[model samples]
Target chain A: MSVQSKPRVRVPATAAKGELIEIKTLISHEMESGQRKDSAGKAIPRKIINKFTAAFDGKVVFEADWQPAISVNPYQSFFYKAQKSGAFTFKWKDDDGSEYTAESKLTVT
Target chain B: MPNWFGIRTATATRRQALTAGAAGALAVLLPRMVLADEAAVADALKKLYGGKAMAEGRIKLDVPPIAENGLVVPIGVEVESPMTEADYVKAVHVFADGNPLPGVVSYRFTPDCGKAAAATRMRLAQTQNVVCVAEMSNGTLFTAKSNVKVTIGGCGG
Candidate 1:
């Protein structure tokens, strides 16, 4: 990865048991779609975060397969049931086999 | 998809005949503008569903009717489901009719997700319709689509 990638997650600090809380995640990437040509009229190579995954306590909860059409900085949001207090891990896998990860904690009562 | 580019009419050299190899080479040599259309989207759906009939219900698509910018068009999808182990949304696949490719994003949701809903932003080359399909745990499918008009195209070089 030639560019620096940053992952940010937003999870509520507290939730009631059985609460359906929204989890938002965003990452910065160019997401070159390979459809663009450079100054020399050559197609630009596609480099993007192809996969995104969310896990709670090591159990996968939500996953997304992103195509080249995703925006430059991908922003994804989903709902998760807050059963217990745990840390949610978000992973973004890039085309070059690079993985960017971020974590957020939620406390369920 | 097969018509992404047209057959080159360039004069063939003595060594390079108009063979399949040469056609392939010519395809690479020429800069052909390619964009997926409604037919491409239909083909993608057919490939995924394999002729299975998709019922039109329990699915909702949230996209602006007119987008201020094409680079970041916010899109949302929600499928009505219990979110239980026995009944839940298995996956959601999204496609666009007017993009470089029909496939936009695919989502897999587990029971841990209390709601079978997701949102993300995408790039639109022009004004087009976005189609989304959801597969349920019981082997049922649902679909929805919405059109968005873009003021500025986002996929140009």
Candidate 2:
């Protein structure tokens, strides 16, 4: 039931105006699917991260749709061409209707 | 030894009846099972790609055709776009047709991104089709798919 995102993300401090750079993100979550059974044989209520998004300087850079099948502590990596230097924000939404967010700075040279 | 004829006649009749029933049932149910998997995959693809209706071949899904691990498989997606204010790739959606839940991930991008690509490790339950869908700047959608044969079962199979 707890949702948290990484405090920082590392992208190259500088890149050619249109150079592609690797971006990595991680979130802290249990990602429980309510379908499983507990010790007492009762169905464990599903708690899963349903969505994720990354934005740079107010523009959307990446987004993801998550399902109960995804494992705990989701990890994702992707690439984006650096056109400017600014802050990238990561956000995640869980099935329990909770939201968690994190941000990192990008320096495009 | 003395009742050989009676035994032969009874056995022959029983075998004939069993064969006739099995043939009839097979004729009725064989196609359904054979086509069920394809139908399920198709249904999922439609849901993922048809949202915007205009599918442009802009999505690239990169994964090994044979994954040794079911617990963790690496998946990478990239779309052809300029990532600029005037136009950019908006979102990317991924699907594993045979996975318990076919929809795996969705990524949204904006103009400042400069480039558009995502890599992540995912779980695969079995050998199945993996699909990628991308939404473009003007609300257009594009899709691509590939079938992967999993050597080791990931989902307790």
Tens digit of lDDT per residue, candidate 1, span A42-100? Answer: 88899999999999999999999999999998999999999999999999999999999
CA shift at B2, candidate 2, in angstroms? Answer: 36
Cα lDDT tens digits, model 2, B1-157, are 7599889999999999999999999688544322114466567657755434656577778988998886678888888887778788888777777765666777777665567787877777678888777778887878788878888755431
Error of 1 at A16 (Å): 0.8
Model 2 residue B151 lDDT score: 84
Indicate the TM-score of model 1: 0.87
Error of 1 at B112 (Å): 0.7
Misplaced by over 4 Å in model 2 are: A1-8, A16-18, A38-42, B1-38, B44-57, B85-87, B138-140
Best by DockQ: 1
* lDDT scores of the candidates, listed in order: 0.91, 0.72
Q: Stretches of candidate 1 above 4 Å error?
A: B1-32
TM-score of chain A of 2: 0.86
How many backbone clashes are present in model 1? 0
TM-score of chain A of 1: 0.97
Best by TM-score: 1
Colliding pairs, model 1: none
Question: What digit string (tens of lDDT, one per residue) describes model 1 on residues B1-157?
Answer: 4343333323344336657678897688545657799899989988988879988989999999999899999999999999999999999999999998999999999999999999999999889999999999999999898999999988877
